[model samples]
Each structure stands twice: as C-alpha cells, then as structure tokens.
Target: MTGLDPELADATGKMLTQAVAEVVGDDPPVEVEESVVLGNAAEVLLERSCGAELLVVGSRGHGGFSGALLGSVGQHCVQHARCPVVVVRGSVS
Candidate 1:
C-alpha cells in the first residue's frame, strides 16, 4: 500500500490505468489490473506475492535517496517476497 490520501490515491489509480494503456496499446498481450491499497507497501506486496508468478516493483518510489540502488520497499520485497521479483528502474528524463 502506498499510504496515499484518498483523493491522491484515486488520481494515482487513474494514472496507473492510463500508463498501462499507453504501454500496452489497444490489445494487450497480457492481462493487467491496477489498484492501490492502504498499508505498508512492502508487507502488502509480500502478502499478495504468495500465489503470484511474479512481483514487479520499482527500484525507488516517490520518496527515497536518488542515488541508492534500491529503495527500502523494493529491497525488502526482493529479500522476502515469495515469488520472483522484478525491480524496474525508471530512466531519468
């Protein structure tokens, strides 16, 4: 969970949908579901990872040391997740 305010969370969900659409285009080859949960991000993600084939997470999220190789959440998930974890690092624009 991101712990975002309700208003921001709603906007984030919409943005996530839009981003996925932009990436996959009209007919995505794979199914995708976007959601935002409220709680500790790592713990929530870990819980959901139980039956998942893969768990993808960002190298660093909204707030973190920019120079770090991985953020706390990503690091935690990488260390403890039950499934394969993919840590995607965003390019700096």
Candidate 2:
C-alpha cells in the first residue's frame, strides 16, 4: 500500500520486498522492484504494470459484503492491468 504517509509507505514497500525475497529464497532469487506512489494504489499499480510481465496483489476484501471475494483495488487491477494479474487470497485454517 502506498500514499499519504511517507513512513507507512516506506515500511510497506520494504516489508513487501523483503517478504517476496524471503519467499523466493537465495537458491533462485527473484528479481523484484518496488515503487511507492501517493495516489490510488490500483491506478499506480496498473500504470506501473504496463511494462511488467505480471502483476501480483493480495486480496484484501475491503468492500461489499462481509464475505466478499475481492477488494476494490484487486478487482480493479484484475480488470485493467495490461499484464497478467495474480490475486493471492489469504486462507485461515
């Protein structure tokens, strides 16, 4: 998540980048780049994804009914991203 708060955005970017790197591990590290923007998250992501091979986002489920499938930003990205968009939804056991 990016925008409004500089500290929050920086922390978020760092957290996400670190998480991705850890998930991929050092055996075959993945190439990752992060940008923090001060606008609509989905719009910024979509704009950035134009030159990307794929776009990945987590399902926040922030809108609609309580059990809604996707969040507003995720839904928008899936519909509009130029490249392939992957929405990862967390599962609770």
Runs of candidate 1 exceeding 4 Å displacement: 1-6, 61-67
CA error at residue 79 for candidate 2, angstroms: 0.3
Error of 1 at 22 (Å): 2.8
Deviation (Å) of 30 in candidate 1: 2.0
Q: Model 2, 1-93: lDDT tens per residue?
A: 423577787787889778877666655455666566778788889998898988888887555663466777888888999999988866644
Q: Write the per-residue lDDT of candidate 1 for residues 13-51, one digit (tens) a residue.
A: 889889878877879887765677888888989999998
Error at 52, model 1, angstroms: 0.9
Q: Which ranges in model 2 have alpha carbons more than 4 Å from their true place?
A: 1-10, 27-29, 61-67, 91-93
For each candidate, what TM-score against the reference? 0.75, 0.69
What lDDT does each candidate get?
A: 0.82, 0.77
Q: Which structure among the candidates has the greatest lDDT?
A: 1
